[model samples]
Target: MTKLYTICFLLLIMAFGFLTDAAASESSFVDEIKNTNERFDTRAVPLARQVTEESVLAMEEYQGGSFRVLARKKSIERYRCSRCHTGKPVTAAQGLELTHGNIALAHGTEGPGLTCIDCHHAQERDYLEDKKGRKIDFDHSYQLCGQCHFRQKRDWLGGAHGKRVSNWAGERVVYNCTSCHNPHSPRFAKRFPATYSVPLD
Candidate 1:
């Protein structure tokens, strides 16, 4: 009985030895595959580097020439960032302190409520109209303002708010109302001058 038990233990040891040899053989095979892959990559390294260099050069050329010109055209407009909003004056009124452009009045830290994108949506065009013939034309300045300022428009229509200078007999093209009153800094009575005097100056 003891001899049979010893034979069974020897058979188990032989099975473990075979399993160990199989695992070592798999590990060696994987190492050889990795080494071959590394050698192939080394051979191709110069070609890969040349491709990368050409791509970078092409990118730089495109950015320097066409991209820069397009950026300048888009950015340097009549009313770049500060037209309706009053942080900076528009180009036409650059040096002037109190521009006809929208700025604040009657309070601390006030100006035009219009945002950059508010007027310049839909492919940076200020005006766009749909199929319904309900037109949106910002270049016709008063209409651009009239769209959002319904309350003011109502008053203008009812003859209560806006200043009516001369009753025209012809096609009544009124003044650019935004010229007199800043939509961002609306006033109740005509208290200050048309141009504001900076408090420090």
Candidate 2:
């Protein structure tokens, strides 16, 4: 009986050794497959890990932790809207094609819907307006967005909604609404996954 037990144990050890070899080969194969996949090519791209306070960024203090968001005032292309938005401000209902050129406003529901004037100050072309009739700075457009998307705002404040800066540590810098969502057309269209696994070649 003891001899039979010893034989069974030896067989079990042999099976484990074989499985170990198979697993090691499978792991290497998976590693090679992953290395061949080139989803995002950031080899030559340069990205800043920590943004300074001087740059177009705003330091935010929340209950969870503190972080920074990109400021819009200076970074905006056609900033100081007073530059060309002079005279009567062009409304979205107007000839947006002629004035803004290809700004398709497709958000909001019927009746008392989202219009340029709803968010943007009627007179101040640069500053945004909240539901409370307060002027929101271009840097803090998140405030204006929060009026409608309270849940998302809450999640963002709690570090759940938006993504943090890429490969970040120490001082956390998170992306705001405008970073991912287009204020004009907030909803995202269907798209392919950023990455996926492929069969070994």
- Estimate, for each residue in 1-201, the C-alpha lDDT of model 1 and write its tens digit: 999999999999999999999999999999989878444455544421111111111111211131100111122244543345554435764654554344443322346544434444434344433333344443343444566676875565444655433343322223344446544454556576888877994
Per-prediction TM-score to the true structure, in the order listed: 0.30, 0.62
- Model 1 misses residue 195 by how many Å? 19
**TM-score quality measure for candidate 1:** 0.30
The superposed Cα distance between candidate 1 and the true structure at residue 69, in angstroms, equals 37
Cα error of candidate 1 at position 76, Å: 14
- Against the true structure, what is every candidate's RMSD? 25.5, 13.1
Cα lDDT of model 2 by residue, 1-201, tens digit:
999999999999999999999999999999998988577778665554556533234445688555677655665566888776778656656555666676678778556557789888988887888878898888788888888888998888777898776555556666767878888888899899899989799
Error of 2 at 189 (Å): 0.4
Residue clash pairs of candidate 2: none
User: How does candidate 2 fare on TM-score?
Assistant: 0.62
